[model samples]
Target: MRSAITLEPVVVTAPMQTSPLRVVLDPKRPYQPVPASDGADFLKSIPGFDTIRKGGSNGDPVFRGMVGSRLNILVDGGQIGGGCPSRMDPPTAYIAPELFDKVTLIKGPETVTWGPGNSAGTVLFDRTFTRYEKPSWSFIGSLLGGTRGRFDQTADIRAGTPDFYMGVSANHTRADDYEDGSGHRVHSSYERWNTDVTLGWTPGKDTRVELTAGRGNGHAAYAFSGMDGVQFLRQSLALHFVQENLSETFTKLDVRAYYNSVDHVMDNYTLRRPDPDSAMPMAMASEPARQTRGGRVAGTFDWGDAVELVAGIDGSGNTHTSRSGGPEGSIMGYYRDMPRRRDATISTVGGFSQLTWYLNTHQRLIGGTRVDWAHVRGYALTGDGDSGSLSMGSGMGMGGSAPETTAASRSATLPSGFLRYEHDLADTHATLYAGIGHVERFPDYWEMFGGHVASTVTSFQSLRPERTTQLDVGVQYQTQRTQAWVSAYAGVVNDYILIHYLDGNGAASNVNARIMGGEAGVVRAIGSHWKGNATVAYAWGQNQTEHRPLPQLPPLDVKLGLVYDAGRWSAGALWRVDSAQHRIAIGEGNIVGDDLGPTGGFGVFSVNGSMRLSQEFTLSAGVDNLFDKTYAESVNAISKELQGYTGAIRINEPGRTFWAKLEVKL
Candidate 1:
């Protein structure tokens, strides 16, 4: 007779923290609400994370109320930048989470092993390759279908031997316009696809060399802007070399280099008809592109068994170019033939060293420091007789003024560091930690070249570096049947870059601000067959200079889930609520959009289930917004008037949705 075995229920609502201030998620697992179509969609399932929804896809992610460059995103140890001046495509827009093996998030400035300027946090999407002792092959794939014509397919295949290995990953996703709870259709449709290839060579058990290449493209319709993203194209390449067991004290040596590029296009007529009464009454389109290249070399060392160290040097550079055409029927594709003009360039070089010291059996210390030198140069043309002056009142055009070419440049040297102490309970499975970190951030492309200064003709020469000092504290506990964690942070920002929108133009300025936030979660086993979990996140900010609430902050949000597991199948329910946000800074926000006004509170309910059909196959399905409630996020963009659609000041979420997914491994 054969014996019967039971399997633990899979997490479907939200992932739990594995350690203090750190969360590691398996990208291959199925999640609630809906299967992710992009990186931002996957992040929304975590506490202390939100998205600035623009459409069905390509939304920018915000962590702890910080957006843009404050949140650093790395894919396979490389950085990629978007090209759109209006932020139609963020760094996350180029990432397809399903292709990665693991996603790790480090909340707050707790560590600085990666690059600089990560004031809010750091997120890494990584892929791991195992050495094959003999000839072997593996395959993993999934197919998903849902309401509103949503369909997706993904596949990963690998074959390897002791000395050589190769693997390929690819995915495609598409969705049609979805209706809101009010039975009105929103202009939110999109299609995207990506493919990546990896090759590795292993000469011995301690040495390895690998190379990766990828390409992706997509199009999305937006309900919050006048133009739609007609194209989001990306290309990437990276190489890595690693050697272990070099000597007794020198543990390892690692080196990496990467190149990434993004080419984007936006048009008013491709995805939707141009509003007859809007600013651009005729057909219009713009194309912008950026190229980024960087490299890093680091070594790991151990001093006996008490201390360990990692030191490295890294550098990167990027250039931006754009072109536009419109207002004339005879020049429909003029942008395609026009030459791309380079408007801005940025470069940076930095060196860092981090160490871990084991003081005792129950206590430890960690710290690191880094210094970076940054340079930026911007080009503009104007008729005001002011050399190195540019007008960003409208689009990338010259504002119908005579062209007089000019340029300006600036440089800065900044320093950053962090220290943390951790204590492990001697009698219990728990850990408590406290950390303090400081970072100095150079203004990015948007703050320097995409906006204007209130007091000067350009912001490139006037904007100053931003400095942040923050403290983070957290506790984590785990047992066989229960897991719990809580984390909090408070920070002060000097020369905080604040963007103001007026008369359809954006202006940038510096100010002082204070920010505080926290997140907590717990998962407990009620019985052999039942489990319960809950999580809460909240953030608040104040503009010290203006003595008022900061704009674009997310409200208090909570999530509750219950699951029942029977040997071969499992079912779960999830309830989410968001508190009303009364704080307002009407016209102040980030690069994507400005806040319109206050928002009311709302709640949503969803249910999900999964079944193992066989040893190699699993199926899952879910229904979101069970009550068909109409709601919008507090940190959302203002809606733009379309030709035939009427919407509120902010874009609303989708109505009741149904989806299902199937997976197989061999």
Candidate 2:
């Protein structure tokens, strides 16, 4: 990526990108009134996005009503996978957004430069190194306190000279179980901390090399799942190199290598008492570990000033292993004694190229293509003969039945591409664009290990790659005082992979499906001191094979915001509303969960204020769910238990909560 700096406030009103629906966020900004526990919470502040909340943090993110591999997420250009088969720890769960410099979201399969199978879109959290003109040092720190014993602290420090630099960032956050609007406490408490360090060397004016390392560990309580995350430990390392202006035609060359590992432990005994009547009659614990390694090499070529090309090859490999023990005391730490078993290994290698043709100043054309080779191997490590053994590719890891496994290997070669045309109305400060993209996604480890064995072969061998063909269109309008944008997509998926639960049994299968969605927003500068903005998003889907509405489809949602800004003071109010959802396919869903019948929708309101005390100090505060209204989101998973209600009920959101924050820069 080209390196450049732009000074602007971190806000939702930034100018639109060349790609439709793409949003680039500045993580250092104060636009989000609430403190985000992780990257997922930060995404929730954007329009057209929603999360499947398990509790206060680690909620699964949904874009255009799509989840999982559909949304390819990367941190510092590397992928990180959690060990939990239940997705108790999603990729974002390990990411502390504040530590990153930028978060970019490319909605849909509009480009092929990243990795493969981003049919839903792509999310990138990046931290870029800045060269110092002279010897310098800087620091940023923040402290937060809120209701429910909520508290957080963060610090970032940097010191460097003209040719070298180093920095470190760290944060800690925790919260207790919060009461609902109805005055009932839910099982949602968590504590987390992370620290990252970076070192950089610039040998030449146009060359740079950087190294990064980080470690984090924490535990979180779950309100809807059988087991709580007793431990979430992560370690990461990466090296990146960039050479700009390598030549006139070959303008840039970039390469990177990274390693990430996660150690996770889950147990009912540690966070809650064992349910004697349940299958796990006594305290039990499951420890899982995943290791991922990957690298990418890319270069940019330019032909004159009107045409440019970016080509690259990227590959990644990951292995999953686990150990478990049952019916032990809460203090036993059974994971250490349980036998460790390697269950699965997955890998992918891909090559891609993207081209841009600038046809005059008013029009442009862009195209991209990618090909990937993916492989998966698995084993029945226990040979337990228990068809009910939980496995990664099997259906039972989340909310389904245990999966039977067998030693197996599978491989697939898939191709994907897209073409787009963009037109600019310079005089009117408006732009219009349209594109069509196709992506073939291989079955992930969880999908393979989560499915039941079919025939004499393991389900991992029978599952096919999901194919998505999509068309996207959008328009953006901007002026001195007003900005607006709208984007839409329609797609037909062949061999779409879906899981179903029937009669207490879960199975994975392939089917034909259709999906469509769009998001639109408008921001108007109201006078000099006030601004107003509104946005709306909606998604729809259908199961062609089942002749029913697709499951896990999110309801139409909207947001309205008004902000007032003075020299040193600013305040804002936000209102969010969602329509009720009645369309759902019972017993059918993805790895997350099946549709829980119909759900009612509600609206929420919040207020925020901030003061810029000086160049080095600032303060902010807010009240979320201001009315303390009891409500549940339309796109939600089943709660294991909620406010005395059980059996597939949606988890309630936190009631009226207040928080304050103080920030300092030196």
Candidate 3:
């Protein structure tokens, strides 16, 4: 037999689109700007993706200028919801990208295979399970160290027989406050850890049964908020079953069920001392929690080589509760002893069907439809008499006279669907596609219950479901030496939820809006040992009702990269630039935060390299912001007047930094 051969994968600088409106990423490969600490940080390397920077980690992710529930995020086909009312911990906060095998991103409302209301897009972080031919074992591990006391460790080990398998993975990361280019320290520090275990049984070549459990906890300091995230605890459990090649027509069946919960605590004492002049000057803490349970079942059917169909039903429900206490060493100082108050309960059930018809080898048509029933019941603290004013501690960030108890409930039937056509140019190695999609999204907990209403004391009964109708068009081209893709979308939002902040108080209202954006990228080989790549992304939005520009939209951004590969080692450099944003809606924005004002543009450069030490080990290192440039992203959180932080209105990015990593496989 001939000797086995293998090829090393190149270090990824910018993710290239695999198809129209879709991008696939390899989580195991080394990337520039050091290894990521969380999923949001890793996603930022891709075009058209940005984060609401609040600190060193746990920043909320934004896609195409949209944040919050508009973008659906999933891990192992399961959903995890954060418990912070202020959105300090987004769904991506609990995700450690290094522990997964693959990351798939589908932009726009192009499919209904996942859950409902993904108007922005869908992200799936998946793990692949393999069956052994005989008794076998595998191991993969990594260690990382960086500036400002940054350190990370990860390990994955698996051993299995032909019929049985077991695996476990864990990671830990921490960092201290980082200084800006001017040598001023920002109040940003964090620590996090997570562990997961899996067990599986493979009775036959075409069947699989698996169970998984995970737990994680962490804490992060914030410069934009009055209180820091002192505790973030997560617990999850899931079951999966799959059967393939059942029959000629019944190709496959897949089923999944999961449960997830988040217990979060925020305080001014755990991470830092209370600012003497700030609100709530004494030690205080609030504990908020959420529990989510859901499941999905789908079947795939194929008819010869002409057509295929997939049908599925999915549903999920969740509840939110909170308790608070303040002033250490005094009566009622411990929040743990306070009785938890149930505030909101929400649920959704949906059914979907998707089909693909191969008109010919070069042309195809794809379509899908889904309908969802959503409901919500909110408990509000109401004042006496006819004023209808809410009381303090109502979880609406409002204060009023002593209140009476009240409840409100709302329900809606939503419909969504999409249709697309694709044509492959014969012998040209290119494909062109166009599609249109529509989605109706219900208001989330933060939009309906976290703030006051425009005309009422509360928003629970006044907000309306948002509807989006969009058209997407794109093209893909690939050759022996180059790859390129471009995609664009335009949509109209009816009854769009908008948050307004005035005089330190927040209110929610409905308005009509229009949004448009596009992203393009190209990668080309220059010679035997060199390569070049570039990407650009931009988004624009307007509040049609008021004829003003939408708030919190990211500015035009661009990235350029160059690399040189020698047989055993490689080096790369990246330069990122952003254009100044003058559009402003001031007090109006999303749930995370509102725009401060116009932001000046800036650029930064970084470099990285890697070398194979041996067959089992490899080392990589990089320096970010090599020039120590101090700049803030246009979509960053507004900074508060903290005791020690004297930065600009927005939280600034870290100064010049360095990181190194070591990997081993066995």
Candidate 4:
């Protein structure tokens, strides 16, 4: 007979209280009394972060005023990206947030420890396994149902002993198109599922090895594009080993290797019927895929108690391929007749060293430097294989013709570094810090191969690498009853990649730009049962090359929250406000989507409640857009006219949405 155990009830904290104003988050916590459709939607809780939305799910994450490869996003220390040139399936589409334990965000070009590029920031979703003193089994499950036929199911189970452990997690989520405040459907519907497994071995007293494997697949319907993501398939594998407390001087050694692959399909006939009078006037589909493999070896060194150092060498390589078929009425033989063609290949190797020097109990200094060698190559094919160039250059009116068979490879050695100083005001319980850094970013595949500059230009072979220099400053204050933080950054980018959208077609180019942004938040405990909090974020940018305001920059935004807690019951209210953005440069932006025009802002209010039913169960519910105010997101580029709708309307958000969730632990 098997023994059944009761688990403790989960404490429901504030929706976005991971670390005050910082971008990090605890993925295990419930967000908004319900679960988000994807990782991008969940990032909205962080100040200074926003998403480019075309529908309910798979929105592109935007940090400050930057997008694309400027941001380094990783899952379990590995990189993965959708294959769509138009970004129908972003990297976040594959991540099931609650499956991971921790999510960390490093803003700006402040560090060089992760990978190359990353001028905007670095995002890491990580999972950690704990050792058990005795044999035990644990399980956690959540089910959610909400307005618009939304449904979600998630489960996490683990069994472990002192020397070995294993765990598995599975999730499934689905939703129908939601209606706007005015009772109009937004054409946003999606279904997705993911499963992951892990195994760990504690071979010695201070050594451990772990292996992880995961697979995820999904489909979505878009409101802003003629085509939708018909298939989003992902596979991942990773191995990690650590030997801690090795010696007095050499504190720890760590090594890891990982592989990630994404296979995506986009078409006009899968999710919705093809529009006979639209762009193609026929059924069309394209299949694109990418594979990435990487490894890292690092060690931590300690010099007495005042100095510590972490140094490592890492490398990664990726290949992008695609095939297209069914341009006319027939949908048959699309995959079998279409042959895959290689389009791009990129590889990079780098070494870095970061050190922390404690100047005393109340002060410290930190610095780091890195050097990377990168190689980028593109292939041109003749005849049918020419789909590589045709599909890549379709938007620029250069698809039908292919340059003579040719192969070009470019190489560059880039260096990046940062330095910062910190001081603590013990009496006031506050800390202040400042830093400056510079990074050189190699052009990514989307920038180099996705679109052509002109009929005379083949690939973006002549494009220059981008370089950014930035200064960051911040302050943090904490006490028994209150906590607050403020962070800001300003930077100049040389040879920034910009995509120009014209008459439904687009092209990629390079230009100089300047950017600045900051975020601030404060939280206070009003009484034994009350709490209040507020946060604000703003960003500004300029197209230095064109002498005009940069496009796609978000305007000033603010959020306020009030909460009441009594024993096992809790309730809260949240309000969000945004300011109109008048700054505009009509046609320039990043690869994901371009700036359509200036946008007016609006405010929204929501309320939530939760109750602990028992030691092993809990219930929570919430209503978003409580007033049912209609508004459009500021970062979106698709206009109602662009999506074949009447007038110049923007995609309106969902109306008053009611949602409830049940959680159980055993």
Candidate 5:
């Protein structure tokens, strides 16, 4: 094993960013969110990042050109479930921005540094303890408000010395129905809260021990779903130890163990008051919850001169359970969770290692692989042992294990690998790089129970793993007044997972689609105080065999922005235009939302400003959907409509609004 070495990208990773604002969700940079919605919602402000729109919150982001299980999302090293089955409660929604220190995103399948099947790269939201050269204290806070009675508040405080440290943080967020371009009020409302605490000890110069505990809960209304104000509750605890500056031969060492539990509830009992004509048929409720508890141990080593290696293992099992007796219109006891709640603890274990070598001053290479082993056990749910939704195909508490099909009574092994090469230009600040990768992902819970077909990757197999073989290449350049990057990739996927659906005959159908495309972006600093960023991307994938455009392939799009940063103040403007997308299928979807519906091209504009008030305090604010454009990112459900669109395409965006943030360091 070698010592741990620093590996950081020169520029920040964003979703085909056509704006100067970097992706705040990326773990490498520190981002403070004052908005009161789930974390992923904040990401939509970036270019090339869109969602399966249903009018309101809980929209799952599609980055670059990948979505669903293709993207690996983790928080404080924990894998949290996205509460909304249609992804209204994306994993980021379950996390509070005030709880963590930084967010990181690695775009594309250029590396295999994270866990299993992240063919779309990895996203990590991390937390780090505060350290002081001497005894010190600090506070960070933010407030936000917008149209439709929207508002949010957050606060974090930390105090400590080199020998001992402690910190705490919390937040509250709420919103009401909003009107789209058509002046139609949307029922997108939610309320959430979070709190965290950590105590640390620095016994000597290079060692530290820490203990952590926290709890969070919230409820939200969805225009895309039939229910409202679904409840979200969670509690978690963790223990960690760290040792740095060990020796030149062993640069750094770290170990962490954690246990977390979530008690989520979804019901119309809170927001849906009995209104005869308001689409209320009695009531809908579900208290289903998914609980996942696990622990991990990892280490990093750096080999002197030219090599660095990282290896570690993690294991965790999750289970789902619920009980409900309600009206036919009510999906009571139907708590939406990752991998539909069955009476079983699906367990997974995996290990990984990566080695980077400096072949020469002009070249480098990274090679690594990861293997995951999982055991899934579940039984059918027969409605209090009396009658059941078996006829509805929703019973998940009775079926026995498929021993012969699974590797270990209910388990299987997954593996992925990657390789890369790079070179720097002579007498210039530029680099050219390319790589090839092979990645595989075991079917996710949504891809299983949520899927109407027997298999997504195979003809009849039950959710066979999705595999992708990709080739990636790109270039970057920087000058005193200009910066630019152009990335292009092409890959042929085997068993490419595609979706299918129908609504009358003209409703678009995504037959067997194979997808392939590329993205490009650039920013030039104009003369003295002006900076401009622009990007254009086009992707097309389809059931190559079916000869149809891939369902939901991002349409031809363009983004442009201008920024002026000077001393303690920065101001910027953002504008985006997207071509209409007619390609779509009604059903094939991941847990959150699905398919393409009819859409017309539209444009949106926004403005933002930030200022450093003092050495210790900084303030920032921005207005999203500046022009209050009305558009549907994509359909949440083709067979139905969220709130109302006459048909199924729900094209609703927020009206003109304002948001603000404040940060303090002491």
Candidate 6:
């Protein structure tokens, strides 16, 4: 693809090791808030990023046209399970933006470095270790409060020398139930804190190694769903190595390994379960607890300016057990987690190569391929719940069934490809570029046994996978008077799996469907100190054979932001809008549950500002939903109204809130 060249060639691409599409932080950038409360939360500001609101917490992030397991998220290169299986905490909840120096997103089928099965794409969040010429130290902090009892704080301290470095950071946030534009009180109280430490060593001019660890906890009352969060925990560790410009042939080499664990607790009676009269059904508030643990290792080699290769391996396991009147009053039951081995194991090995050719400087070509082999074998002690067996592709013409014994094995090989072209013009400061990509992903566990069940199917019939082939293209133009870029894409998803929910009993099943979408963003830099970014996106899905709109396809959305910046201070305002969704499936929905009819259209405004405190420190703050807008993002089963059970349950997004953050360099 050829992009209209800009006056200035922005060289912001990430290193070969973590290839995230680069995001520049121009303090004045509107819509873009400082480090977000969580990974997904921060993503909301991105043009095509949206969250399905349940209540105060646990919003699932949707990108391009994919959500849930289709998108792969990694922390320092480690693939970890999202905390809430029901997604109360969502994977992004465990992250603190203050801890990462860079955030990168690879849109579309992922490369081998991030493991596999990410048809939606891969996101990489990382913290870099900056070296110092001599022993030095610095500190940064932030404070904020606004409309709905909103308040937040963050701090970071760093010390380092030419040969060694150490750094640590902590953050906290809270908000009272918010009042919407219509003067409606929305459920929305959330508070959380996290601390992380990193130590690094630079043994030579081109070599470096680092170790990092962190822990966090929090809870939120959902507004969209019926449940309130009782408790959540996150712990992780990571190790990294970097070698640069190793030789004329190899530009760099990177290797990393890491581990992550989530311990979660919930109850319906604790917050505001609707049914308080349930005598026997009343859980002790802590009857349920679930945990997942796992780790991964990967290596990358950058071949000068032409080729790059990444390879990795990973594994994980999950276990869940509940007790009657146990921890918090959740449900009346007593069952310490059973010895879990299978439900807790997911192992994968993969490799990918990317190539770039300077087809005569004025012209260039890019092509790459990736492959991954994953073996998943897990067993859950479902007890007497019709525990039958494994089915590979039950609903589709895939493959299938195996006895639901202690040992069940399923292996899948995924392949992906990409190609692109760029042309430079000597007549003007401009270039043009275009590209296409195809990717296939294995079905996730949630897609497996969580919903549908079949009698006689293929080997491991429940695990039937899906494949996709797509094409994307864009144009960028820059002139003394204007700077703009537009990208569009269309794809056909074959065997797209979707969960169908019949009612409140969580009896869900799967159906293969199709989906399509398009997105575009443009920035116009009027003049010195005046700038704006505008984006619009729309996505659609249909069960062509079934002749119905696919479930949970995000509504059409648009974003606009204006910003002003100076040497040390910056300010901005952002507006977000969405078209009313009238095409929703209200019948026997499966996997993702209710399409909950039509979602009303809504608009929200946000404002933010920042100041440089010194040569080494900076401060920033912002207020979201400035007008305290009230709306539901998307509906999922976990978001069921919890008015009766008087305990912790899953819900949706909170109301208007504020946030602040600070950073320092030494």
Residue-by-residue lDDT tens digits, candidate 6, 585-629: 665343334576777788877777777776555666777777767
Q: Residue 170 in candidate 3 has what lDDT? A: 93
lDDT of 6 at 208: 88
How close is every model to the real structure, measured as TM-score?
0.96, 0.94, 0.96, 0.93, 0.84, 0.82
lDDT of 1 by residue, 36-95 (tens): 899999998989999998889998899998888898899988889988766788899999
Candidate 6 has what TM-score?
A: 0.82
List pairs with backbone clashes in candidate 3.
none
Candidate 3 lDDT by residue in tens digits, 184-226: 7888899999999999999987889999999999999887777
Candidate lDDT values, in order: 0.85, 0.81, 0.84, 0.78, 0.61, 0.58
In order of TM-score, best first, we have 1, 3, 2, 4, 5, 6
Candidate 1: segments with Cα more than 4 A from true spot: 326-329, 381-395, 402-405, 451-458, 642-644
Total backbone collisions for each predicted model: 0, 11, 0, 0, 33, 97
How well does candidate 4 score on lDDT at residue 603?
Answer: 95
Instruction: Pick the winner on lDDT between candidates 2 and 3.
Output: 3
Candidate 4 lDDT over residue span 193-285, tens digit each: 999999999866588899999999989888877677878899999999999998899998989999999998877777778787765556777
What candidate 6 gets wrong by more than 4 Å, as runs, is: 1-35, 224-226, 272-274, 277-280, 284-344, 381-407, 425-431, 451-460, 478-482, 505-512, 564-571, 588-593, 607-623, 626-628, 634-638, 642-666
Residue range with the least summed lDDT across 10 consecutive positions in model 3: 384-393
lDDT of 2 by residue, 426-506 (tens): 788888999999999998765666432221244555678999999999998888888899999999999988877665445
Query: Where does the lowest 10-residue lDDT sum fall in candidate 6?
Result: 9-18
Task: lDDT for model 4, please.
Answer: 0.78
Off by over 4 Å in 2: 1-19, 31-33, 326-333, 381-386, 389-405, 451-458, 641-648
Q: Please state the error at residue 459 of candidate 2 in Å.
A: 2.2
By lDDT, the candidates rank as 1, 3, 2, 4, 5, 6
